[model samples]
Target: MTRRDIEFDAEGVTLRGWFYPAEGATGPAPTIVATHGFSAVKEMYLDVYAEAFAAAGLNAVVYDHRNFGASDGEPRQEIDPVAQVRDYRHAITFASTLAETDPQRIGVWGSSYSGAHVLVVAAIDRRVKAVVSQVPLVSGLANLYALVRADFVGGLRESFDVDREARYAGDSPAMIPVVSEDPLGPAALPTADSWTWFTDTAKLRAPAWRNETTLRSVEMFTEYEPVAHIAAISPTPLLLMPAQHDHLTPTRLAIDAYERAREPKKIVILPGGHFDAYVDGFSVSSTAATDWFVEHLQP
Candidate 1:
């Protein structure tokens, strides 16, 4: 149950978070490289999952994504899926170098947006021997249309265009709330559950958590297609956990993406909305991921 504050280099950015060494481990242990989704920081229940893995005799390297949380990056609060994907690989490299980690026995666990990132990472990174993608975004375009009203789609695109021009003119990137009190209001995640989970979690756990992100972050999200690489994750052992009624990263999308993924994969449907995986269904979600890593990574 020992945890330490740690930092590592991702490209040029310094990402920081807590690392938990496996309890009662004798030597280098199988490790999982993990991070939060979208604009979330490590403090948003990532520690809870890491502790579960560590208690199960697996080393866990949990860190913040660049430009978020304790991580160091410029044009702060920006989220570029491409950059985040590269950072996941860098995290793998960082985990591989740790004395307490078995480089050959590495896994990756990501939830929500990061859940999709792990899918893409497992496809291209041979270093990841096992992967757990929880309530992941399969297709950005699809998820966007699912959450946003059809009539407002055009207006949303126009906002992105306007932000692009402002940024080009050297103005600071326009920002938007990650979640809002009104589900009908403008926000990156405009669901009632997202609003409740994020606001409540921030108040109870991570006060430093911000509710804003660069407007361009939403633009980048519309173009990400992580599920396209789901099939490539085969032979590496994939565990796709989607919530039963997830609306943010709709359950159907995750189920469909799981179908596209090759064998050596298993799907476990959680018993609530998307945010419930980190709250009400945390035990189910964390235990599933911990056992998957132990079975495949052999920690």
Candidate 2:
């Protein structure tokens, strides 16, 4: 239950993080790096998973993506998939140096956008012993297609605006609301409940959480495709936890990624939608994650 604030430099960017050690952890223990999804802070779902892992005798490191939360970056809130994947590598490297962690027993757990990130990281970094990609966004192109198909004109306009802003500022672009006011709506905006939850959560965060990112993040979709790298990670343990009714990242996409991945893998389909995995019915996915890490990393 012991927690500490930490900072590390990644590719020249000063990144912020939290380290959670098991209550009685005195010796080397399996460790987990918990990364959050797009537009979310480490304080969101990472804490939930971190506490659970710590209770189970694992040390947990949760960090903010550059440009969001307490992390340092320019053109704030811009989604850079390449940067995200790089940050994962940096986090894993940093976690390996912790005195309380077993350097060889390192696992990466990512949700939503980061789900795909962890996979890409594991593929490139043999040091990653295990991976958990929860409700992953496998193909950025497919995701964009889905958005355009839902509302072509609106999607186009949003993309144009994001691009214009990024070009104008000569830096990273911003993004629109990924969740919708109406869960069933064609275009996405934060749901009323989601907005409320974020507002409440913000009150508990530190000063480092005050940054806002640009909207030109759509560019990353065309540049980074994590699903294509799945087969390259042969023999590494992977766990895909997809929500049955996930609207943010389609369940079908995650299933396709699972099918393409190499052996030593598992697919756990849980009930509820995307946000539900963070709020209501979260225990379903959380428990599955705990068991997965215990079986793969702790062993």
Candidate 3:
């Protein structure tokens, strides 16, 4: 196998990425660009997915969004939805120029927050031939509403506190633990498996993955909705894999978005919550995703 860490210029930002090619493979092959989700880095998912695609004779490009991970940017952990989408587009453009890649067969893969990004990117950019959104958060408002309903007063207080700290520290607002020990709260903050996945993954990262995102991120996200553009991606294959018991992103939202999407789309519902598929013990969903990309990209 051939692997290289590369950097590319995108919208005045220097994006960091990794390219993986199968060993002894020659000539161009189908390429997939994988983007990470909120508070996650490229290194988290790149290795597993890249190896899967590369073993199937496909090249994979995994990139870190600017302002997060190893990518160059100020105000670390600030979630800029527009910038994230732009980075996705730049990754595709960079993949297209690779001599070992089939530019016309480019695919986009994303999960959680980025899952929605993949949809919007493919809709606006006709160059994207295929997309795989795993347990995607189709609507920002839906997610926030869920969060609020779970703990209206507490959620509001937390948001304000985060915003204050962010401004005082001259940084983006920080979020509470996705899973906590408290009761009567968002399941994402209390689930045992969610904690395991995050802590274990943090151990594998440098500086221990400190992802304190801007509190105003919610404010920005409330106005951004990827489901609104699903129809724009007609003719291109879209795979929607929603976790049955997902708490981070409700499965119903994903199903609704898939139903609204145009022809040439597929929906696969797996058993588990939002983060289950990313960790161990949820091989069904992960395998289904791998197969979906392989089938569509046709390496």
Candidate 4:
């Protein structure tokens, strides 16, 4: 497997990352386009997944979402679900243009936030032949409610309004930690596991990973609903992988969304929490996705 640094224009923003050509392939081969979740960048184990796909004779394009990691965008660390979805389509277009890519044999693989994005992308973009959405956010509003305390919900909304006003007045967007040591602290992801996984992964694999994002990013997240597009992803084969003990995206919510998806779809229940899918359960998660892509894309 060989990896090369690559970038392409997504609208006007320049998104950058690695492209791994399928190993031992003599011609154009099936390709998988992937990006990370939430505030994650390509360095945080995305390379590992890409290598796995490449070694299995499937080309892999792995990049960071705009405004994070090596990607170019304004407001540095903002998270806009709508923009991310559009970027995924742009990535597909770029992938289709590659010499090593069999445009018709393209599959999409995403986990967590991008997982949800792939669901929406596959529904609207017929160019996507197959999809693997792992531990995706089904309903952002529901997820916010699940992760936040009832008493804090109103305050959180108020903070959003306050931040909007500040931004309207030309003040820089307010920043918030992506995760915190104190579970009850104000952060995008408050789970103990999120803190551990993000901090530890950053330390070991991605020094460029930051701990902050714009406050409005959280507001935008609460308004996202990718599951609304789930049922439409049929005809295009779908593989839904939800971790058994996930609380960040909630296992039940993922299962419910999976039930709504039409046929030519399958689900693999991973044996750990959300973050575990990338670490402890990586072999299971990556293998399931690799096999699915192989079955459908025939790389």
Evaluated with TM-score, which candidate comes out highest?
4
**Cα displacement (Å) at residue 52, model 1:** 0.4
Q: Which pairs clash inside model 1?
A: none
- Clash number by candidate, in order: 0, 11, 9, 0
Model 1 C-alpha lDDT per residue in residues 206-238, reported as the tens digit of each score? 987999999999999999999999999989999
lDDT of 2 at 8: 89
Q: Could you say which candidate leads in lDDT?
A: 4
Q: Candidate 2 residues 1-299, lDDT tens each? A: 67899888898998898999965667888889987877778877678789888988888989999888888997677778899999988988898888988999999999888988998998999988888888888888777665455556476656666678767888544445544446544323234544554555557653344323344565565456899899877788998998998756788888988899989999999888766777676788888888888888775
Off by over 4 Å in 1: none
- Candidate 1 local distance difference test against the native: 0.93
Task: List the candidate numbers ranked by lDDT, top first.
Answer: 4, 1, 2, 3
Q: What TM-scores do the predictions have?
A: 0.98, 0.87, 0.87, 0.99
Q: Candidate 2: global Cα-lDDT?
A: 0.78
How accurate locally, in lDDT, is each candidate? 0.93, 0.78, 0.77, 0.95
Over the full model, what C-alpha lDDT does candidate 3 score relative to the true structure?
A: 0.77
In candidate 4, position 190 carries an lDDT of: 91
Stretches of candidate 4 exceeding 4 Å from the true structure: none
